[model samples]
Target: MSAIDNLPPLREVIATHQLSARKSLGQNFLLDLNLTAKIARQAGDLAACDVLEIGPGPGGLTRGLLSEGARKVVAIEKDTRCIAALQDIAAAYPGRLQIINGDALEIDPLQHLTPPVRIAANLPYNVGTELLVRWLTPPDWPPFWQSLTLMFQREVAERIVAQPGGKAYGRLAILAQWRCEARIAMSLPPEAFTPPPKVSSAVVHLTALPEPRYPADAATLSRVVAAAFNQRRKMLRASLKGMAPDIEDRLIAAGIKPTDRAEQISLEGFCALARELRRP
Candidate 1:
Protein backbone atom coordinates (compact mmCIF):
# COMPACT_ATOMS: atom_id res chain seq x y z
CA MET A 1 0.00 0.00 0.00
CA SER A 2 1.06 3.58 -0.47
CA ALA A 3 2.56 4.96 2.73
CA ILE A 4 0.40 8.09 2.82
CA ASP A 5 -2.68 7.27 0.75
CA ASN A 6 -3.11 3.49 1.20
CA LEU A 7 -3.00 2.96 -2.57
CA PRO A 8 -0.72 0.44 -4.25
CA PRO A 9 2.97 1.19 -3.95
CA LEU A 10 4.19 3.31 -6.87
CA ARG A 11 7.02 0.88 -7.67
CA GLU A 12 4.56 -1.97 -8.00
CA VAL A 13 2.36 0.17 -10.21
CA ILE A 14 5.38 1.16 -12.31
CA ALA A 15 6.57 -2.42 -12.61
CA THR A 16 3.07 -3.66 -13.36
CA HIS A 17 2.64 -1.07 -16.09
CA GLN A 18 6.21 -1.36 -17.38
CA LEU A 19 6.73 2.36 -16.88
CA SER A 20 10.17 3.91 -17.06
CA ALA A 21 11.36 7.50 -16.96
CA ARG A 22 11.31 9.29 -20.33
CA LYS A 23 13.99 11.96 -20.66
CA SER A 24 12.63 13.63 -23.77
CA LEU A 25 9.55 14.49 -21.75
CA GLY A 26 11.73 15.73 -18.88
CA GLN A 27 10.33 13.01 -16.65
CA ASN A 28 12.12 12.24 -13.40
CA PHE A 29 9.68 10.26 -11.35
CA LEU A 30 9.77 10.87 -7.64
CA LEU A 31 9.10 7.39 -6.27
CA ASP A 32 9.31 8.33 -2.61
CA LEU A 33 5.74 8.67 -1.36
CA ASN A 34 7.00 10.10 1.92
CA LEU A 35 8.88 12.90 0.20
CA THR A 36 5.87 13.75 -1.90
CA ALA A 37 3.70 13.84 1.21
CA LYS A 38 6.07 16.35 2.75
CA ILE A 39 5.89 18.53 -0.37
CA ALA A 40 2.08 18.44 -0.17
CA ARG A 41 2.17 19.53 3.47
CA GLN A 42 4.29 22.53 2.52
CA ALA A 43 1.45 23.97 0.45
CA GLY A 44 -0.14 24.91 3.77
CA ASP A 45 -3.82 23.96 4.39
CA LEU A 46 -5.52 21.97 1.63
CA ALA A 47 -8.80 20.95 3.24
CA ALA A 48 -10.97 23.06 0.95
CA CYS A 49 -8.52 23.99 -1.80
CA ASP A 50 -8.19 22.60 -5.32
CA VAL A 51 -4.78 21.42 -6.57
CA LEU A 52 -2.99 21.85 -9.91
CA GLU A 53 -0.26 19.28 -10.41
CA ILE A 54 2.09 19.25 -13.38
CA GLY A 55 3.90 16.15 -14.65
CA PRO A 56 2.34 13.72 -12.20
CA GLY A 57 4.85 11.02 -12.98
CA PRO A 58 3.36 7.86 -11.47
CA GLY A 59 1.00 10.02 -9.36
CA GLY A 60 3.16 10.17 -6.24
CA LEU A 61 2.49 13.84 -5.47
CA THR A 62 -1.03 13.57 -6.84
CA ARG A 63 -1.86 10.97 -4.19
CA GLY A 64 -0.27 13.06 -1.47
CA LEU A 65 -2.40 16.09 -2.45
CA LEU A 66 -5.60 14.10 -2.22
CA SER A 67 -4.56 12.33 1.00
CA GLU A 68 -4.03 15.74 2.57
CA GLY A 69 -7.73 16.48 1.88
CA ALA A 70 -7.57 18.67 -1.18
CA ARG A 71 -11.11 18.92 -2.50
CA LYS A 72 -9.92 18.08 -6.02
CA VAL A 73 -6.73 17.63 -8.02
CA VAL A 74 -6.23 18.68 -11.65
CA ALA A 75 -3.19 16.80 -12.90
CA ILE A 76 -1.63 17.52 -16.31
CA GLU A 77 0.97 15.17 -17.74
CA LYS A 78 2.43 15.15 -21.24
CA ASP A 79 3.81 11.62 -21.33
CA THR A 80 1.26 9.10 -22.57
CA ARG A 81 2.75 6.26 -20.52
CA CYS A 82 2.08 8.20 -17.28
CA ILE A 83 -1.54 8.69 -18.24
CA ALA A 84 -2.15 4.95 -17.77
CA ALA A 85 -0.38 5.13 -14.44
CA LEU A 86 -2.36 8.19 -13.36
CA GLN A 87 -5.59 6.52 -14.47
CA ASP A 88 -5.02 4.03 -11.70
CA ILE A 89 -4.70 6.91 -9.24
CA ALA A 90 -7.83 8.59 -10.59
CA ALA A 91 -9.68 5.34 -10.13
CA ALA A 92 -8.44 5.05 -6.58
CA TYR A 93 -9.73 8.52 -5.69
CA PRO A 94 -12.90 8.45 -7.80
CA GLY A 95 -14.23 11.91 -8.71
CA ARG A 96 -11.61 13.84 -6.76
CA LEU A 97 -8.78 13.27 -9.25
CA GLN A 98 -9.02 14.77 -12.74
CA ILE A 99 -6.33 13.89 -15.25
CA ILE A 100 -5.57 15.95 -18.34
CA ASN A 101 -3.32 14.01 -20.65
CA GLY A 102 -1.45 16.82 -22.42
CA ASP A 103 1.35 19.30 -21.99
CA ALA A 104 0.62 21.58 -18.99
CA LEU A 105 1.84 24.56 -20.99
CA GLU A 106 -1.05 23.99 -23.37
CA ILE A 107 -3.70 24.04 -20.64
CA ASP A 108 -4.72 26.79 -18.27
CA PRO A 109 -5.71 24.96 -15.10
CA LEU A 110 -7.25 28.20 -13.81
CA GLN A 111 -10.05 28.30 -16.38
CA HIS A 112 -11.09 24.66 -15.80
CA LEU A 113 -11.15 24.94 -11.99
CA THR A 114 -12.78 27.04 -9.30
CA PRO A 115 -11.21 29.35 -6.76
CA PRO A 116 -9.28 28.44 -3.61
CA VAL A 117 -6.77 26.63 -5.78
CA ARG A 118 -3.13 25.95 -4.93
CA ILE A 119 -0.58 24.63 -7.44
CA ALA A 120 1.56 21.86 -6.01
CA ALA A 121 3.92 20.10 -8.35
CA ASN A 122 7.21 18.27 -8.63
CA LEU A 123 7.39 19.92 -12.05
CA PRO A 124 9.32 18.55 -15.00
CA TYR A 125 12.55 20.55 -15.04
CA ASN A 126 12.38 21.94 -18.58
CA VAL A 127 9.02 23.67 -18.30
CA GLY A 128 8.99 24.63 -14.63
CA THR A 129 10.32 28.18 -15.02
CA GLU A 130 7.95 28.99 -17.86
CA LEU A 131 4.98 27.73 -15.86
CA LEU A 132 5.92 29.70 -12.75
CA VAL A 133 6.30 32.93 -14.75
CA ARG A 134 2.85 32.48 -16.26
CA TRP A 135 1.30 32.29 -12.80
CA LEU A 136 3.26 35.34 -11.70
CA THR A 137 2.05 37.30 -14.74
CA PRO A 138 -1.63 36.36 -14.74
CA PRO A 139 -3.36 39.14 -16.76
CA ASP A 140 -5.93 39.55 -13.99
CA TRP A 141 -5.50 39.84 -10.25
CA PRO A 142 -6.37 37.75 -7.15
CA PRO A 143 -4.85 35.00 -9.30
CA PHE A 144 -6.49 31.64 -9.86
CA TRP A 145 -4.36 29.78 -7.32
CA GLN A 146 -3.90 30.87 -3.73
CA SER A 147 -0.36 29.47 -3.54
CA LEU A 148 2.41 27.80 -5.47
CA THR A 149 4.48 24.87 -4.20
CA LEU A 150 6.94 23.96 -6.93
CA MET A 151 10.29 22.22 -7.25
CA PHE A 152 13.14 23.41 -9.43
CA GLN A 153 16.84 22.92 -9.81
CA ARG A 154 18.50 24.23 -6.65
CA GLU A 155 19.98 27.11 -8.66
CA VAL A 156 16.55 28.14 -9.96
CA ALA A 157 15.07 28.12 -6.49
CA GLU A 158 17.88 30.37 -5.31
CA ARG A 159 17.17 32.75 -8.18
CA ILE A 160 13.46 32.94 -7.28
CA VAL A 161 14.04 34.04 -3.71
CA ALA A 162 17.24 35.88 -4.38
CA GLN A 163 17.63 39.47 -3.16
CA PRO A 164 18.94 42.49 -4.95
CA GLY A 165 22.72 43.00 -4.53
CA GLY A 166 23.06 39.20 -4.46
CA LYS A 167 24.48 37.00 -7.21
CA ALA A 168 21.26 35.03 -7.62
CA TYR A 169 18.99 37.99 -8.38
CA GLY A 170 17.92 38.78 -11.96
CA ARG A 171 14.85 38.76 -14.22
CA LEU A 172 13.14 35.90 -12.35
CA ALA A 173 13.82 37.53 -9.01
CA ILE A 174 12.15 40.80 -10.01
CA LEU A 175 9.16 39.15 -11.67
CA ALA A 176 8.47 36.73 -8.78
CA GLN A 177 8.89 39.16 -5.90
CA TRP A 178 7.09 42.07 -7.57
CA ARG A 179 3.81 40.21 -7.30
CA CYS A 180 4.17 37.34 -4.87
CA GLU A 181 5.86 36.49 -1.62
CA ALA A 182 8.22 33.59 -2.38
CA ARG A 183 10.81 31.60 -0.44
CA ILE A 184 12.62 28.29 -0.65
CA ALA A 185 10.87 25.70 1.51
CA MET A 186 13.02 22.58 1.06
CA SER A 187 15.69 20.89 -1.03
CA LEU A 188 16.19 17.38 -2.45
CA PRO A 189 19.31 15.81 -3.86
CA PRO A 190 19.74 14.30 -7.32
CA GLU A 191 19.46 10.79 -5.84
CA ALA A 192 15.79 11.33 -4.96
CA PHE A 193 14.56 10.73 -8.52
CA THR A 194 14.04 7.43 -10.34
CA PRO A 195 16.39 8.76 -12.99
CA PRO A 196 18.09 11.46 -11.00
CA PRO A 197 18.83 14.90 -12.42
CA LYS A 198 22.45 15.88 -12.37
CA VAL A 199 21.72 18.97 -10.28
CA SER A 200 20.10 19.05 -6.84
CA SER A 201 16.55 20.42 -6.53
CA ALA A 202 14.65 22.62 -4.10
CA VAL A 203 11.01 23.48 -3.45
CA VAL A 204 9.73 27.07 -3.58
CA HIS A 205 6.62 28.29 -1.80
CA LEU A 206 4.92 31.42 -3.17
CA THR A 207 1.78 33.18 -1.97
CA ALA A 208 0.35 35.78 -4.32
CA LEU A 209 -0.50 39.23 -3.06
CA PRO A 210 -3.76 41.04 -3.80
CA GLU A 211 -1.71 43.36 -6.03
CA PRO A 212 1.88 43.90 -6.93
CA ARG A 213 4.20 45.82 -4.58
CA TYR A 214 3.60 48.79 -6.86
CA PRO A 215 1.32 49.60 -9.78
CA ALA A 216 3.09 48.12 -12.82
CA ASP A 217 1.77 46.06 -15.68
CA ALA A 218 3.13 42.49 -15.62
CA ALA A 219 3.76 42.46 -19.37
CA THR A 220 5.77 45.63 -19.26
CA LEU A 221 7.63 44.42 -16.21
CA SER A 222 8.41 41.14 -17.93
CA ARG A 223 9.87 42.91 -20.95
CA VAL A 224 11.83 45.35 -18.83
CA VAL A 225 13.24 42.72 -16.52
CA ALA A 226 14.14 40.35 -19.33
CA ALA A 227 15.91 43.07 -21.28
CA ALA A 228 17.74 44.45 -18.28
CA PHE A 229 18.97 41.03 -17.21
CA ASN A 230 19.98 39.99 -20.72
CA GLN A 231 22.81 42.45 -20.39
CA ARG A 232 22.99 42.26 -16.60
CA ARG A 233 26.56 43.29 -16.09
CA LYS A 234 25.98 46.56 -17.92
CA MET A 235 24.53 49.58 -16.13
CA LEU A 236 20.84 50.41 -16.64
CA ARG A 237 21.64 53.34 -18.95
CA ALA A 238 23.51 51.00 -21.29
CA SER A 239 21.33 47.94 -20.88
CA LEU A 240 17.91 49.59 -21.22
CA LYS A 241 18.95 51.48 -24.32
CA GLY A 242 15.91 50.28 -26.25
CA MET A 243 13.58 52.64 -24.42
CA ALA A 244 13.04 56.31 -25.35
CA PRO A 245 16.05 58.58 -25.74
CA ASP A 246 15.70 59.75 -22.11
CA ILE A 247 15.56 56.21 -20.69
CA GLU A 248 18.23 57.14 -18.16
CA ASP A 249 16.00 59.99 -17.09
CA ARG A 250 13.20 57.49 -16.73
CA LEU A 251 15.31 55.16 -14.56
CA ILE A 252 16.30 58.13 -12.49
CA ALA A 253 12.62 59.08 -12.22
CA ALA A 254 11.97 55.54 -11.01
CA GLY A 255 14.51 56.27 -8.26
CA ILE A 256 16.90 53.63 -9.59
CA LYS A 257 20.47 54.67 -10.09
CA PRO A 258 21.32 55.06 -13.76
CA THR A 259 24.53 53.19 -13.02
CA ASP A 260 22.82 50.22 -11.29
CA ARG A 261 23.06 46.80 -12.93
CA ALA A 262 19.81 44.83 -13.24
CA GLU A 263 20.84 42.50 -10.41
CA GLN A 264 21.63 45.45 -8.19
CA ILE A 265 18.09 46.87 -8.23
CA SER A 266 15.37 45.64 -5.91
CA LEU A 267 11.96 44.30 -7.02
CA GLU A 268 10.33 47.62 -6.13
CA GLY A 269 12.94 49.42 -8.17
CA PHE A 270 12.14 47.29 -11.20
CA CYS A 271 8.45 48.02 -10.74
CA ALA A 272 9.27 51.69 -10.67
CA LEU A 273 11.05 51.32 -14.00
CA ALA A 274 8.13 49.38 -15.44
CA ARG A 275 5.77 52.10 -14.28
CA GLU A 276 7.94 54.75 -15.85
CA LEU A 277 7.99 52.82 -19.11
CA ARG A 278 4.21 53.01 -19.17
CA ARG A 279 4.42 56.77 -19.24
CA PRO A 280 4.04 58.75 -22.49
Candidate 2:
Protein backbone atom coordinates (compact mmCIF):
# COMPACT_ATOMS: atom_id res chain seq x y z
CA MET A 1 0.00 0.00 0.00
CA SER A 2 1.09 3.55 -0.62
CA ALA A 3 2.18 5.45 2.48
CA ILE A 4 -0.33 8.21 1.98
CA ASP A 5 -3.33 6.08 1.03
CA ASN A 6 -4.70 2.54 0.92
CA LEU A 7 -4.07 2.38 -2.84
CA PRO A 8 -1.34 0.15 -4.27
CA PRO A 9 2.22 1.44 -4.41
CA LEU A 10 3.14 3.21 -7.67
CA ARG A 11 5.77 0.63 -8.69
CA GLU A 12 3.39 -2.29 -8.29
CA VAL A 13 0.65 -0.40 -10.07
CA ILE A 14 3.07 0.40 -12.93
CA ALA A 15 4.19 -3.24 -13.10
CA THR A 16 0.65 -4.54 -13.13
CA HIS A 17 -0.45 -2.05 -15.79
CA GLN A 18 2.79 -2.22 -17.79
CA LEU A 19 2.88 1.55 -17.65
CA SER A 20 6.37 2.53 -18.81
CA ALA A 21 7.29 6.16 -19.18
CA ARG A 22 7.33 7.26 -22.82
CA LYS A 23 9.90 9.80 -23.98
CA SER A 24 7.69 11.20 -26.74
CA LEU A 25 5.00 12.09 -24.20
CA GLY A 26 7.58 13.65 -21.86
CA GLN A 27 6.68 11.14 -19.16
CA ASN A 28 8.82 10.77 -16.04
CA PHE A 29 6.99 8.86 -13.33
CA LEU A 30 7.61 10.19 -9.81
CA LEU A 31 7.27 7.13 -7.56
CA ASP A 32 8.10 8.55 -4.16
CA LEU A 33 4.91 9.33 -2.25
CA ASN A 34 6.84 11.26 0.40
CA LEU A 35 8.24 13.58 -2.25
CA THR A 36 4.88 13.84 -3.99
CA ALA A 37 3.19 14.85 -0.72
CA LYS A 38 5.89 17.44 -0.21
CA ILE A 39 5.12 18.86 -3.65
CA ALA A 40 1.42 18.96 -2.74
CA ARG A 41 2.11 20.75 0.55
CA GLN A 42 4.06 23.39 -1.37
CA ALA A 43 0.81 24.39 -3.06
CA GLY A 44 -0.37 25.64 0.34
CA ASP A 45 -3.66 24.54 1.92
CA LEU A 46 -5.69 22.66 -0.69
CA ALA A 47 -8.62 21.91 1.62
CA ALA A 48 -10.84 24.58 0.08
CA CYS A 49 -9.33 24.65 -3.40
CA ASP A 50 -10.06 22.72 -6.58
CA VAL A 51 -6.79 21.84 -8.36
CA LEU A 52 -6.04 21.45 -12.08
CA GLU A 53 -3.21 18.99 -12.62
CA ILE A 54 -1.58 18.41 -16.03
CA GLY A 55 0.14 15.22 -17.29
CA PRO A 56 -0.60 13.14 -14.17
CA GLY A 57 1.50 10.09 -15.13
CA PRO A 58 0.50 6.97 -13.17
CA GLY A 59 -1.39 9.37 -10.83
CA GLY A 60 1.47 9.75 -8.38
CA LEU A 61 1.04 13.50 -7.89
CA THR A 62 -2.72 13.08 -8.24
CA ARG A 63 -2.69 10.92 -5.12
CA GLY A 64 -0.55 13.49 -3.37
CA LEU A 65 -3.03 16.33 -4.01
CA LEU A 66 -5.98 14.21 -2.88
CA SER A 67 -4.21 13.11 0.27
CA GLU A 68 -3.71 16.75 1.19
CA GLY A 69 -7.55 17.19 1.32
CA ALA A 70 -8.08 19.12 -1.90
CA ARG A 71 -11.79 19.69 -2.40
CA LYS A 72 -11.42 18.27 -5.93
CA VAL A 73 -8.70 17.53 -8.48
CA VAL A 74 -9.22 17.64 -12.25
CA ALA A 75 -6.30 15.80 -13.85
CA ILE A 76 -5.63 15.89 -17.61
CA GLU A 77 -3.66 12.91 -18.91
CA LYS A 78 -2.69 12.15 -22.54
CA ASP A 79 -1.67 8.55 -22.01
CA THR A 80 -4.41 5.93 -22.37
CA ARG A 81 -2.48 3.37 -20.37
CA CYS A 82 -2.79 5.60 -17.31
CA ILE A 83 -6.58 6.09 -17.44
CA ALA A 84 -7.33 2.76 -15.86
CA ALA A 85 -4.49 3.37 -13.45
CA LEU A 86 -6.03 6.66 -12.36
CA GLN A 87 -9.45 5.05 -12.05
CA ASP A 88 -8.02 3.20 -9.09
CA ILE A 89 -7.25 6.55 -7.48
CA ALA A 90 -10.68 7.94 -8.32
CA ALA A 91 -12.37 5.01 -6.66
CA ALA A 92 -10.22 5.50 -3.61
CA TYR A 93 -11.21 9.16 -3.32
CA PRO A 94 -14.83 8.83 -4.55
CA GLY A 95 -15.98 12.04 -6.32
CA ARG A 96 -12.92 14.06 -5.46
CA LEU A 97 -10.92 12.90 -8.50
CA GLN A 98 -11.83 13.63 -12.12
CA ILE A 99 -9.65 12.24 -14.91
CA ILE A 100 -9.76 13.55 -18.47
CA ASN A 101 -8.03 11.49 -21.14
CA GLY A 102 -6.81 13.95 -23.77
CA ASP A 103 -3.96 16.21 -24.77
CA ALA A 104 -3.44 18.95 -22.14
CA LEU A 105 -2.46 21.39 -24.89
CA GLU A 106 -5.83 20.93 -26.59
CA ILE A 107 -8.07 20.77 -23.52
CA ASP A 108 -9.25 23.91 -21.68
CA PRO A 109 -9.09 22.90 -18.01
CA LEU A 110 -11.01 25.96 -16.78
CA GLN A 111 -14.30 24.61 -18.13
CA HIS A 112 -14.04 21.66 -15.76
CA LEU A 113 -13.17 23.73 -12.71
CA THR A 114 -15.07 26.18 -10.50
CA PRO A 115 -13.98 29.21 -8.49
CA PRO A 116 -11.19 29.14 -5.83
CA VAL A 117 -9.03 27.18 -8.27
CA ARG A 118 -5.32 26.48 -7.88
CA ILE A 119 -3.22 24.72 -10.55
CA ALA A 120 -0.67 22.34 -9.09
CA ALA A 121 1.20 19.93 -11.34
CA ASN A 122 4.43 18.20 -12.22
CA LEU A 123 4.08 19.30 -15.84
CA PRO A 124 5.42 17.50 -18.93
CA TYR A 125 8.77 19.08 -19.81
CA ASN A 126 8.15 19.66 -23.54
CA VAL A 127 4.98 21.75 -23.10
CA GLY A 128 5.77 23.40 -19.75
CA THR A 129 7.02 26.74 -21.09
CA GLU A 130 4.23 27.03 -23.66
CA LEU A 131 1.61 26.35 -21.00
CA LEU A 132 3.15 28.94 -18.68
CA VAL A 133 3.18 31.58 -21.44
CA ARG A 134 -0.43 30.82 -22.27
CA TRP A 135 -1.46 31.20 -18.62
CA LEU A 136 0.59 34.36 -18.18
CA THR A 137 -0.95 36.05 -21.24
CA PRO A 138 -4.61 35.44 -20.64
CA PRO A 139 -7.05 37.97 -22.14
CA ASP A 140 -8.22 39.19 -18.72
CA TRP A 141 -6.61 40.23 -15.49
CA PRO A 142 -6.98 38.49 -12.09
CA PRO A 143 -6.90 35.14 -13.94
CA PHE A 144 -9.13 32.19 -13.11
CA TRP A 145 -6.66 30.55 -10.78
CA GLN A 146 -5.68 32.05 -7.43
CA SER A 147 -2.12 30.69 -7.77
CA LEU A 148 0.07 28.39 -9.84
CA THR A 149 2.34 25.72 -8.34
CA LEU A 150 4.13 24.23 -11.34
CA MET A 151 7.26 22.17 -11.76
CA PHE A 152 9.66 23.02 -14.60
CA GLN A 153 13.30 22.41 -15.52
CA ARG A 154 15.62 24.24 -13.13
CA GLU A 155 16.82 26.43 -16.01
CA VAL A 156 13.27 27.41 -16.93
CA ALA A 157 12.43 28.08 -13.26
CA GLU A 158 15.43 30.41 -13.05
CA ARG A 159 14.23 32.24 -16.15
CA ILE A 160 10.77 32.69 -14.63
CA VAL A 161 12.17 34.40 -11.52
CA ALA A 162 15.20 36.03 -13.10
CA GLN A 163 15.77 39.76 -12.53
CA PRO A 164 16.64 42.43 -15.08
CA GLY A 165 20.26 42.53 -16.37
CA GLY A 166 20.72 38.77 -15.79
CA LYS A 167 21.38 36.33 -18.65
CA ALA A 168 18.19 34.44 -17.77
CA TYR A 169 16.12 37.60 -17.88
CA GLY A 170 14.30 38.23 -21.18
CA ARG A 171 10.75 38.03 -22.48
CA LEU A 172 9.71 35.41 -19.93
CA ALA A 173 11.05 37.36 -16.98
CA ILE A 174 9.17 40.51 -18.03
CA LEU A 175 5.92 38.70 -18.78
CA ALA A 176 5.95 36.76 -15.51
CA GLN A 177 7.10 39.50 -13.17
CA TRP A 178 5.28 42.50 -14.66
CA ARG A 179 1.94 41.41 -13.20
CA CYS A 180 2.59 38.55 -10.81
CA GLU A 181 4.67 37.61 -7.77
CA ALA A 182 6.77 34.55 -8.72
CA ARG A 183 9.38 32.56 -6.79
CA ILE A 184 11.14 29.22 -6.89
CA ALA A 185 9.53 27.28 -4.06
CA MET A 186 11.71 24.16 -4.19
CA SER A 187 14.24 22.26 -6.31
CA LEU A 188 14.44 18.54 -7.06
CA PRO A 189 17.27 16.38 -8.35
CA PRO A 190 17.11 14.31 -11.57
CA GLU A 191 17.11 11.07 -9.62
CA ALA A 192 13.67 11.89 -8.15
CA PHE A 193 11.88 10.57 -11.23
CA THR A 194 11.61 6.97 -12.42
CA PRO A 195 13.31 7.86 -15.71
CA PRO A 196 15.67 10.57 -14.57
CA PRO A 197 15.78 13.65 -16.79
CA LYS A 198 19.25 14.98 -17.58
CA VAL A 199 18.38 18.35 -16.03
CA SER A 200 17.14 19.04 -12.51
CA SER A 201 13.63 20.41 -11.83
CA ALA A 202 12.16 23.14 -9.61
CA VAL A 203 8.66 24.19 -8.58
CA VAL A 204 7.56 27.80 -9.06
CA HIS A 205 4.72 29.48 -7.18
CA LEU A 206 3.17 32.56 -8.83
CA THR A 207 0.32 34.61 -7.41
CA ALA A 208 -1.41 37.09 -9.70
CA LEU A 209 -1.52 40.75 -8.76
CA PRO A 210 -4.95 42.40 -8.46
CA GLU A 211 -3.69 44.75 -11.19
CA PRO A 212 -0.57 44.99 -13.33
CA ARG A 213 2.41 46.53 -11.54
CA TYR A 214 2.83 49.00 -14.38
CA PRO A 215 0.53 50.53 -17.00
CA ALA A 216 0.71 49.21 -20.59
CA ASP A 217 -1.37 47.26 -23.09
CA ALA A 218 -0.61 43.54 -22.89
CA ALA A 219 -0.39 43.07 -26.67
CA THR A 220 1.83 46.10 -27.23
CA LEU A 221 4.02 45.13 -24.32
CA SER A 222 4.42 41.64 -25.75
CA ARG A 223 5.37 43.01 -29.16
CA VAL A 224 7.84 45.51 -27.70
CA VAL A 225 9.44 42.92 -25.43
CA ALA A 226 9.61 40.40 -28.26
CA ALA A 227 11.23 42.89 -30.59
CA ALA A 228 13.74 44.02 -27.98
CA PHE A 229 14.72 40.49 -26.97
CA ASN A 230 14.56 38.97 -30.46
CA GLN A 231 17.73 40.90 -31.24
CA ARG A 232 18.90 41.11 -27.64
CA ARG A 233 22.49 41.95 -28.54
CA LYS A 234 21.43 45.07 -30.48
CA MET A 235 20.87 48.44 -28.78
CA LEU A 236 17.20 49.32 -28.07
CA ARG A 237 17.02 52.00 -30.79
CA ALA A 238 18.20 49.62 -33.54
CA SER A 239 16.29 46.55 -32.27
CA LEU A 240 13.00 48.44 -31.98
CA LYS A 241 13.37 50.35 -35.26
CA GLY A 242 10.89 48.04 -36.98
CA MET A 243 8.33 48.67 -34.21
CA ALA A 244 8.20 52.48 -34.42
CA PRO A 245 9.38 55.08 -36.95
CA ASP A 246 10.96 57.34 -34.28
CA ILE A 247 12.29 54.52 -32.09
CA GLU A 248 15.13 56.60 -30.64
CA ASP A 249 12.76 59.47 -29.71
CA ARG A 250 10.40 56.96 -28.05
CA LEU A 251 13.32 55.45 -26.12
CA ILE A 252 14.31 58.91 -24.94
CA ALA A 253 10.68 59.72 -24.09
CA ALA A 254 10.54 56.58 -21.95
CA GLY A 255 13.71 57.76 -20.15
CA ILE A 256 15.69 54.76 -21.44
CA LYS A 257 19.08 55.09 -23.07
CA PRO A 258 19.04 54.22 -26.76
CA THR A 259 22.22 52.16 -26.41
CA ASP A 260 20.79 49.85 -23.72
CA ARG A 261 20.35 46.21 -24.72
CA ALA A 262 17.21 44.19 -23.93
CA GLU A 263 18.81 42.48 -20.93
CA GLN A 264 19.48 45.82 -19.27
CA ILE A 265 15.86 47.03 -19.50
CA SER A 266 13.69 46.58 -16.41
CA LEU A 267 10.01 45.60 -16.55
CA GLU A 268 9.02 49.21 -15.87
CA GLY A 269 11.36 50.34 -18.65
CA PHE A 270 9.76 47.89 -21.06
CA CYS A 271 6.28 49.09 -20.03
CA ALA A 272 7.33 52.69 -20.62
CA LEU A 273 8.63 51.83 -24.09
CA ALA A 274 5.44 49.92 -24.88
CA ARG A 275 3.37 52.92 -23.81
CA GLU A 276 5.41 55.17 -26.08
CA LEU A 277 4.80 52.82 -29.02
CA ARG A 278 1.02 53.05 -28.42
CA ARG A 279 0.99 56.88 -28.47
CA PRO A 280 -0.41 58.52 -31.61
Task: Please tell me which predicted candidate would have the highest lDDT against the true structure.
Answer: 2
Q: After superposition, how far is residue 82 of candidate 1 from its true place, in Å?
A: 1.5
What is the C-alpha lDDT profile of model 1 across 1-280, one tens digit per residue? 6679767888898898888988887888888899899999999889888898998988999988988888899999888877888887888789898999888888867666777899999989889999988888776987888899999999999999999888898878887888789999999999999888999999999999888788888788888888888998899899998976899899989998899898888778888888999999
Runs of candidate 2 exceeding 4 Å displacement: none
lDDT of 2 by residue, 85-111 (tens): 999999999999999999988998888
| Candidate 2, backbone clash total | 0
Record all residue pairs in model 1 with backbone atoms less than 3 Å apart, i.e. clashing: none
Off by over 4 Å in 1: none
Q: C-alpha displacement of 146 in model 1, angstroms?
A: 0.7
- C-alpha TM-score for every candidate: 0.95, 0.98
True-vs-predicted CA distance for residue 101, candidate 1, Å: 0.9
Compared with the true structure, model 1 gives a TM-score of 0.95
